[model samples]
Target: MPELPEVETTRVGISPHIQGQTLHQVVVRDARLRWPVPTDLAANVEGKPLRRVVRRGKYLLFEFDHGAIIGHLGMTGSMRIVNHEEPPAYHDHVDLVFSGVTLRYRDPRRFGCILWQENPVMAHVLLASLGPEPLSDEFDVAHLLRACKGKKQAIKSLIMDGKQVVGVGNIYANEALFMAGIHPHRQAGRISAERLDRLVVCCKQVLSAAIKQGGTTLRDFVDSEGKPGYFKQQLQVYGRAGQACVTCDQHLTESRLGQRSTVYCKRCQR
Candidate 1:
């Protein structure tokens, strides 16, 4: 799935083209996404000016005057800005047409969603319980330490929890833990406050770097320009299973945690 960085990159990439532009039309080729595309989406949003595009965790918000459209780029979904006259591809499931350009949503798996929200967006069911943004001041060391209290879940799982700290997905969690020298399976409450501080910093650093590099393109992720991310080249542990550890030259170990593949340098972590 497209994580925080990839979603943020898409938000940044499509903003300039659609912001302040009136929605000419909304074409939903398939309404059977993760959830049915809101039946009244086009009726409610067409002709309204799109105010801005923003990201919360892995969801993208297309803000307008009265409400917003929420989008999730599931395991293989992507958004791109293309010319208004461009033809839709086989996987192009939705298009938000504008005067001069079109914002296209393409997803092969149909696991993504495009929903409408008429209430306060933050209070919406999909977003109401989400944790603080990883790159924001709300995710400081003190906040993380407090959230970690009395929790026995693996530190990696804790960080990946959207309710604990949004947007620390599998890949970034591995990279951030490796950067902080924390083992992936360590109990959250057992970690020291000082180490938690380092982990917080590493999370922000890894996420910021990933966003700067256009996100990690493990498979289907791509920027609005349809370019793959470059951060995969900078990964230290996420997918380096059986590879020599860069720090100690020991073979990195791989395991399954929460059904997700985890790679770590045993000697370097813990």
Candidate 2:
């Protein structure tokens, strides 16, 4: 699934081509996605101009004059810019054709979505209860500390909870915890405020850096331009189990927390 950074990368990549441009057409090859694509989606956006393409967590918010299109790259979906005359492929589920360009969506798993929502989409149910973006000022040590209070859940699980702070996916959760020197399985409530501060900082740093790095592309994730991200090459712990820790010079350990693989250095993280 595309995380926050990858979504942001898509937003930035496509924004240049579609922003302020009038839509010439919309083609829906398949309406069956994670949720059925709204049948009237094309009619709502076809003649209007795109105002912006923004991202909230893993969802893309495509703002237009009349309404907005909100989509999610569920697990194996991607958007790319193609010439208006280019032919659609087998997995090309949707296309927003403009005067000179086309924004194409391809999802092999049919797990993505194309939904039309009224303007001001932030208040939609899918977005209403989401926590602050990890790179935003709204998320901080105090925020995470308050959210973690009275919880015996694993620290990694706590951070991965979307209601606590959106977009800390499995990979980022491991990286942030390792950067903070916090064991992934530590009880949430048992973590001290001081350590929570470290965790908060690391979350912001890691997330911002990942966004700059265009996300870690170990598998299906790629930037909107169809290029793989290089951040995975810099990972210190997420997938480095059985490898030596760069900081403590000890072997890193691997475990499963909340059914997600976790990598950490036992000697460095307590």
Best by TM-score: 1
* Candidate 2: tens digits of C-alpha lDDT, residues 213-242: 998897797777889887888899988899
Q: Which ten contiguous residues of candidate 2 have the minimum total lDDT?
A: 119-128
Q: What is the lDDT of residue 229 in candidate 2?
A: 81
Candidate 1 on 39-113: residue-level lDDT in tens?
899999998999989888999999987889999999999999999778999899999999999999999999999
Each model's Cα RMSD: 0.7, 1.2
TM match of model 2 to true structure = 0.96
Model 2: lDDT equals 0.88
TM-score of each candidate?
0.99, 0.96
In model 2, what lDDT does residue 198 have? Answer: 95
Q: For each candidate in the order shown, give its overall lDDT on alpha carbons.
A: 0.94, 0.88
What TM-score does model 1 achieve against the real structure?
A: 0.99
